[model samples]
Target: MNTIHTHFRLSYKIYDEAFALSQAAQCHLYLSLSQKAIRFAVVDTARNKFVVLEDYELITVFTPLQVAEQLRLIAQENALLQVQNWKLVRVAVSNQQFTLVPETLYDPVHQFDYLRLHADLNPLQHEVYTYRHSGLEAINIFAVESGVRLALQGVFENQPLQLVHQTSALIRSILHVVPRNNLRSMYAFVERSYLTLLVVGPAGLEFCNVFHYTSPEDFIYYILFVMEEQKMNPEQETITLWGDITHDSSLFNILQKYVRQIKLGKKPEDVEYSYKFHDMFDHRYFELYSLHLCE
Candidate 1:
């Protein structure tokens, strides 16, 4: 019997000529799941280089089950995602239901308590989880929708897998490339309706949080609010942006109006990328690419 499957829109995709389905066992699979999109990338562990990347923009989905359905459709059509023989599978869930706790104060037994302080959680629908940042000595407390979590677990039932929040991945990636000068800098991971802002300094990750905005004004307002709260000067401090934004974008225009040093971040340099990805924007897919850096 032929089952009809509706697929999400593919926003961007790149594959190296050397990539092959037969090499799944020798590579790592990274999936970044969010309310508005699901992006996945493949890395050739043998050479420590990225070989495949695909981004799918999902239709508006309100429930966890609806997001799971969209994921299933994309997996059914994606040859790379259908394989279960990857050397490692890491999934990063992107949402606002997350918080950062200092390592010394983190209590695994109280994961729910740590996260509930920052966001409300529906025990039946959302599962609280924690990812330890070894380098920064912190614990990331976040929630994942049960349906989506179950769907991914079912997909790679026997394969080695790890799950983390998208903000965790972004923080890991940002710290990896934080300037040697150790200057306090603001990093913004922009999405369609939200952005994850992080302030990293010489000591390590100082602040991390997600903000939802509807317009350009709302976007800059949050940026400036964070700056004022952190005592960062708009005319002197630098803010580097990444993810779903461009130089000519209205969001960028508004950002430049207030911030003096506005820079577009590049992909992580710690890992290599296939030449096919050379033409792609460096700042885009910062979370998806950073999954490779996650344990």
Candidate 2:
């Protein structure tokens, strides 16, 4: 129940007293998958509350195929993931193979073309997918590994499933929680060694991109670089942090040294969480929890 494979370790888990396998028909399942980790959350739609959450950390880097194999093992062993009667299922893929295009200009036939500008495509290993963000008036064109996509589909064969990029979920949840008073700000969503940065203003989303870093220096460098390019004054503007970081962590410490106003982001305000979730960091599992906001 704790480890799916030798590499996939159950970092933590939380379950509400109200959660029951028999009530899956009234619940929604959200999954976040990446080379570094895989996590999932279950929400009871009837009460608009999260009932269960689990985080699995990969001890070492995994190829898409390896991740798929671990996911298969997880599906076979995890009781919650085995249920197919859920009201909704959404899986968010966290990776660098994604780009955003204006909704007005998006063409279904050219999804591949749009993504090619940002990432190389391998038909044998990757599959192209797109998600429309109505609130932001944009289309997120992304690639998911064929192996991972197939594994997810096979697990939920009897139910409808929506696959989205991790950024989509982050954007939806951040927009919902960030004050919309026309104040521009920066937000960071951290994962293993990957960092996703977003700049929002009165008009809407200004800039969004992801970076891969190996050290705290690399992490802070990207933030400063983006802020300069976006004409944001780090001294005056606020930068909010979420996912895989702590106030005392090296990442946070390095960021605080350069940015004048840095704060930790909270969970999405629109949804409710069970009391059991209070013990976990509110900013962690943000992308997974925000899957509820994805259409």
Candidate 3:
């Protein structure tokens, strides 16, 4: 059989957040190619009360008929309720760069990876999971650790970017580092003692970010203080910070710092799982909400 060897992906048209609706008006949208379509959209302003104008674009190497058939399956699963200001925008993407496999391929890989990774951790002290994944344009920097895993493009709007430069810089600044390479001081004790996750953004916007602090305590206390001052509890029930303060401001560095804190406070006692999901606050998650669109 002749094959196209084409890449596949599903682009979605997500509309504006609609006004709060009644329970009857609540709706969800999803897509499927094989047997069951997965639930991808759910407008739960209250309890599944709001709806939005969204559609799914299926990309594939299959014939047009195959694609249309898949679309029918999807529509049958999710009937078109109504219409709104939704436009179908065709974006030319370089599938060559990425495998661009059907999300069906990635979701399972991601799921298994998540469960397997979850099984191996310190459990006590380390109990959090969040990382800023790289955009489709660039690869993320978190594939090296035995205990760590990538959260990837899902952390934010499924856009190519999980963390924008401005958002990244905001995280860096919020951590209180000046972003200087030479200035970053890494104590040997800390390096030998902790795991590291370095987060890099385009310089100066590019890599000009460089700075160092006296101790990991400076960064740790700052984060704790920020949480406390803001009157918000750090989401994770327990935190373990096992790394040194005087290190790079990359995601790895910041995480190591936080891990050290977790160890000091939460002992991770009686937790079934040993793996920890350490995630950091990427300012972009909030910053992008403000802009509400790609510029």
So what's the TM-score on candidate 1?
A: 0.96
Which is the better candidate, 1 or 2, if ranked by lDDT?
2
Name the top lDDT candidate: 2
Q: Supply the global lDDT for candidate 1.
A: 0.88
Clashing pairs in 1: none
lDDT of 1 by residue, 1-295 (tens): 8543454699888999899989999999999887788889999999999999998987766556777888887777678877979999999988899888889998789989888888989899998888999988888888998988888987888889899999988988888888756689999999988889999888888889899999999999999999999999999998999999998999999999999999899999988999999998899889988898887
Candidate 3 lDDT by residue in tens digits, 37-142: 1113223323422233333444442332344344334433343322211221111110001111223234533532443342342333222222332322221111
> What's the lDDT for all of these models?
0.88, 0.89, 0.27
TM-score of 2: 0.96
| lDDT digits (tens) for residues 1-295 of candidate 2 | 7554567889899999878999999999999998888899999999999989988887665587878878887888899889989898899998999999998999999999899999989878889999999987899999999889889988998887999999998998888887777789999999878999999998878899999999999999999999999998988989998999998889989888889998888888778999999988788889988898888
Listed per model in order, the count of residue pairs whose N, CA or C atoms clash below 3 Å is 0, 0, 37
User: Which segments of model 1 are wrong by more than 4 Å?
Assistant: 1-7
Worst 10 residues of 2 by lDDT: 1-10
Comparing 1 with 3 on TM-score, the higher-scoring candidate is 1
